[model samples]
Target: MKVVAIGGGTGLSNLLRGLKKEVGNRIEDLSAIVTVADSGGSTGRLRKAYHIPAPGDIRNCLVALSESEEIIQRLFQYRFKGGELDGHSFGNLFLVSLMDITGSFISAINVASQILRTKGEIIPATTEDIHLWAEFSNGEVVEGEENITEYGKTSKAKIVRVWIEPPDAKPPIDAIAKVQSADLIIFGPGSLYTSIVPNMLIEDIKEAVEFSNAVKVFVVNAMTQPGETDSYTAYDHIEAFLRTTNLSKIDITILNTKMPSDVVLRRYIEQGQEPVIPDVAKIARKGITVYAEDLIGESQDFIRHDPDRLTEVILRAVSHALS
Candidate 1:
């Protein structure tokens, strides 16, 4: 199977971890299309200082697919403490250095992949240094990925639309080719606005996905994002995808049917987030297949998709689609 997963952040990385395990020898090719519009923390700082696409998300995805030793992975993920480099990750810095030396972001990623012995490839949605901008329903316009999320949380208005700064930014040909040749294309398990949707903001990517013959699956976030999808349900997430991109319908929609315990739920509720209700009937009414399962898992008081369970659900969906 040729699998192509799209999105960024921890969600995509988490999914990749299980995907690498599940696909094992079955995958003919695997690729990840990551969003580079991030302008937060280490990624943001690097983007501003070096005029490069954010490497944070790419670094995470690379580690997720890495076939290297556990200690090597830990080293790549290690963050500096108590210095000018305090919050920066070693992997991000290493990637930046490679970009400088290789004189191409794509080349740097390839070198890093070789070093990590990654099971698959990782490609940025676009090679350009792009910033994400959003227009709130309140008629307020915000620039920067981090700023948009922060403003959304406090603004009285919902996010109306989001777009990349260049507006004409095109995804790399490699990214488009991967999507075009994919057997299965997965969309999120990530933030609706910042992580996943940003990739679709690129015109080329959106068009490529729309025209692809792959079995498209959208993995709905297990929990509502405080600033992005505050009160959104499963159907609302799909609605956002349709409204934002040229893609008309998702073939299969994966929903987490189980909820976390109250203790874990309370922590998220305190942060103004809640479990995303799986409105199966409403979703299926759109002529889409709804695959609901107990995909939630709690770790360190954080609720996330149980990677193994998620992998199983995805494989089953693809198998059914093929049959």
Candidate 2:
């Protein structure tokens, strides 16, 4: 099976871990198309100084697929304490050093992948250092993914459109070809604007997804995000996807069925967020098949997708499609 997962951050990494465990050798191919719009934490600092595409998400994906020792994985994820490099992550520094030595980000990633012995391929949506620009419904334009989340609500910025500057930037040819040849394409369980939608803003990447022969699926978030996807339902999530990209209906939409404990729910509410109480039947009525499962991975104050359960649901959907 050739599976191509798209998005950035922990969501995609966690999903990859599950897929790796479940498919074993039967999965002949796996690839990730990660968003490079990150501008926070170690990645943000590195981007400011080196002018390289953010490596945080890409690094995470690499480690997730690594067939390496736990110690090596820990080394990549470790963060130094209380120094000039205090805020920088070990993986971020490793990637920058590799790029500096190799003189190219793509080549650096290739080296890193070999060191980790990752089972799958990973590529950026674009090799260029591009920023994400969002035009809100109120006619105000937000320039960066990090900035969009801080805009106040009365601002009424509806994310009217998103585009990459130097709009002619092309995605890595390997990334585009992977999408075109995918048996199944998956998007999101991550931040709507920052992760999934940012990748779609790259014209070439979006075009490849539109032209792919694979069945596309969106793993909807279990909770609505504050500032970006506030008050959004399951269907609203799908609608936002269509509004952002040129693609039409997604073949399958996965929704989390198990409600989180009240303690966890309260903590989320304190943060101005809430579980996405989706009208599942109504979502199905919209023509996209909906699959409900126990997708929540336990966390201290929040809930996330259980990598195993989430992967099971996704593989089942893709398997059904293939059949």
Candidate 3:
């Protein structure tokens, strides 16, 4: 099977970890399309100083699919406790230095993938240092990914639209061809606006997805994001996605049907969050096939996708589609 996953952050990495095991050698091709609109944490700091593509999310995905030794993986994920590099991860710095030495961000990623012995290829949505600008429903325009959370508080301020500046940004050639030849294309279980939608804003990216023969699948979030997608239902999630891109429909929608344990739910509610109670029947009416499974996992403060279970759900959906 050939699969291409779009979006970035932990969502993509988690999915890759699960998929890598199942498909192993049967997987003829696998690719990840990562978002580069990040301007937060170590990635933002690195981008500002070096003018290189943000490597935080890319590094995470690379490590997830890596066949490197356990020690090497641990080394990449290591965080400095104090001093000048406090809170900075070693993988981020390694990528920065690699980009500097190679003189190209793509070249740096290629080298890292080899070092990690990654199972699949990874590509940025675009090589350009593009900025994400989102318009709230109240007519307020928030300029950065980190800033969107603050404005996402109001129900009246739903994301009206999002677009990358210098709108003609082109995708890396490998990225376009992957989508064109993919057997399946999966969107996020990540932040809707910040991670997933930003990828669609790239002109060539939208064009590739819209025109491709690949079967598009969407993995809906289990919980409503505190600021960006609070109180959003499953239907609301799909609608928000279609509103952002040129793609007209999704082939399969993967959702979590079981609610989390009450203890976990309470922890999230304390932080102003709740599960996205999807109306599966309503989603079916929208002309998209709905696949529900127990996808939630236990986490300290936040609910996360149980990567193995979620991967099973995705594979089942694809098998059903192919059959």
Evaluated with TM-score, which candidate comes out highest? 1
lDDT of 3 by residue, 159-202 (tens): 87888876888889999999999989999989898999989988
By lDDT, the better pick of 2 and 3 is: 3
Cα lDDT of model 1 by residue, 182-240, tens digit: 99999999989999999998998998899999999999999999778989999999999
Clashing pairs in 3: none
**Cand. 1 Cα-lDDT:** 0.92
lDDT of each: 0.92, 0.85, 0.86
Clashes of each: 0, 1, 0
Q: Is candidate 1 or candidate 2 better by lDDT?
A: 1
Error of 2 at 45 (Å): 1.3
Work out how many backbone clashes candidate 3 has.
Answer: 0
Regarding TM-score, does 1 or 3 come out ahead?
1
Q: What are the per-residue Cα lDDT tens digits for candidate 2 across 85-135?
A: 897889989999999999988998999999999988889988889887777
Give the lDDT ranking, best first.
1, 3, 2
Worst 10 residues of 1 by lDDT: 21-30
The best candidate by lDDT is 1
